[model samples]
Target: MEYSMLADIDTGEQSSQFLTFIMADEEYGVEILDVQEIRGWEPCTEIPNMPQYVKGGINLRGTIVPIVDLRQKFGFNNIKYITTTVVIVVKVLVEDKSKTMGLVVDAVSDVHTIAHSDINLPPQLGLDTGPRVIRGLVSIRDKMVVLLSSSLLLDLNQFQNIEQINEHKTQQPMATND
Candidate 1:
């Protein structure tokens, strides 16, 4: 289902709307409704025996939220601190319920109002990353921002695994509690 938004663009009678951000020199966007908040990078509690792309979890207002590093997910070389680093907290529907997750990006560019007509489907060829996550492409000031599907971006399989692990942990009799 394609959700459309209003934008203020030079194109007369047609406008573009998008929430744009930067990751590894490329701009990307997600529907505004899917976004919950933009937060500065914070230390995350590491989860053992998980994928490298999964950068552990963060405490958001007393709730534990998992974070994903787009750079690692997209096969970019790991680098030390960069000033542009930020975490975008997105609310995604998982298993019929809304769940919040943090996406680590290089930086946030701007929230653009992208017209529906301005978006172009990404080419099937030569895409290093699989196209399953990317919905389409849109131009913003000579740069193309890949529009990402929040549902696909926040696949809950890993989280489900984490939940299983936690369930086992809880099932085990706690030395202190017992």
Candidate 2:
């Protein structure tokens, strides 16, 4: 189910709803407005010569939506896909274009409303995982929620590959008897 995403943080407004999901021991969230749907994990058509994190692409209706494994994306070991494994469909922005993709997560959690004041900036660690990817840190029910920045969800080059794959799929000829 989709919940309301965070409002403009710069404004320091009232509490905003966020959809939370579990990844290992940590909980992460994203704007609910950007979410398309939540679905059970399904096998996808593996693409050659793509990043390991890019699990593959799935046909959503008629659109080719790329699937991303967040565990692998965050440099984690491949775990067994269980009944809880699910794919969260989300729309992300890249270079003024909105692209739809599926994020393979362990399982989804509860939704909570957090005020802008509660969010704290993530500490700079000088690591390859840039701080820009994270929006901020917030505490709820004695747990810390790491908010993600949808704008920087994936690398620009990855989006290009996904777009190309989509175009290539659409350009293929349909088989029929004349």
Candidate 3:
């Protein structure tokens, strides 16, 4: 399921839906179907021996999910969090299977419907955040929002580790009352 952002845009209902979010001062969007829910920033239990981009896992609705700091993943200068900090839960498909993961962003923005015509290949000009991850751009309230590919936002190896952890937990036997 992990795919680098590409330029092609297909038509139909699947073409326009997106969930917008902010990181630092820039705006970005991911397909709405990929998003699970928006949550306020919560303390994450640090996991030893994991990538720095992996901010660790947090208990979400009684389920543990790994959180990733998009700011760091995009190579932006760190900034202090305010009340606006939020975690976006996205369902990512890996090896043809779906899995949930958390993305930390500065804030959540309005959802937008970007038509196929509005999407274009990212400019050849180099960008600080790396142009490879940008699928296209759309104008939102006089501000340009970069549309991102859901697959590129995550790392496959890390996701696999999350799946393994979940599997291990499930395999453990429960205590008997008797």
Candidate 4:
């Protein structure tokens, strides 16, 4: 879906498209505008001293794109990557500029058109003042889809030294055959 699908002419409501995916049986979406591309699971050049969630980095043409597994990042049980596993390349706002990263998800579900009004603010669990990863929630097809604020999902500072990480690389095995 394109950003051109942002407005409904008849109703005059502002809406945006979301690229939805499934993880641990739950639906999650990232704004379509942030999506750069989707790719199949492939081994990446592993970096030393990075968090478990930071899978590694891949050479996208000439750019070294860091990959992150959402399941691991969100504290879900680790599972072997299969055919359904894919990497969604997205441009996230880091600091003031945009940075490209790959998010490893279970599988892509669909492209949903949701209106701005339909999105509900995420509840505050406690008095924690930490940055929020969830942007909002929306009901689509009678199921709740967690819309993620891509910009806040990853720790911006962790990737600031990407060039250094690229300097040290080894292939990491992430996929398996069952």
Say which candidate scores most in lDDT: 4
Off by over 4 Å in 2: 1-12
Clashes of 2: 1
Model 3, 20-120: lDDT tens digits are 98897889998887898998988798866778878999876756689989898878988776799999998877778777889899999887776667787
For TM-score, the strongest prediction is 2
Against the true structure, candidate 2 reaches a TM-score of 0.88
Please say which candidate is ahead in lDDT: 1 or 4: 4
Where is model 3 more than 4 Å wrong at Cα? 1-14, 125-132
Q: Candidate 4 residues 1-178, lDDT tens each?
A: 4343489788999998999999998999999999999999999988677798999889987678889999999899999999999999999878777888999999999999999999999997786746888989999989999999888877866677685555554445657999
Model 3 quality (TM-score): 0.82
Candidate number that wins on lDDT, 2 or 4? 4
Q: Ranking by TM-score, best first? A: 2, 4, 3, 1
Better structure of 3 and 4 per lDDT: 4
Candidate 1 deviant stretches above 4 angstroms: 1-16, 126-131, 164-178
lDDT of each: 0.76, 0.84, 0.79, 0.89
Deviation of model 2 at 174, angstroms: 2.2
Clashes of each: 9, 1, 0, 0
The whole-model C-alpha lDDT of candidate 1 against the native structure comes to 0.76
State the lDDT at 84 in candidate 2: 97
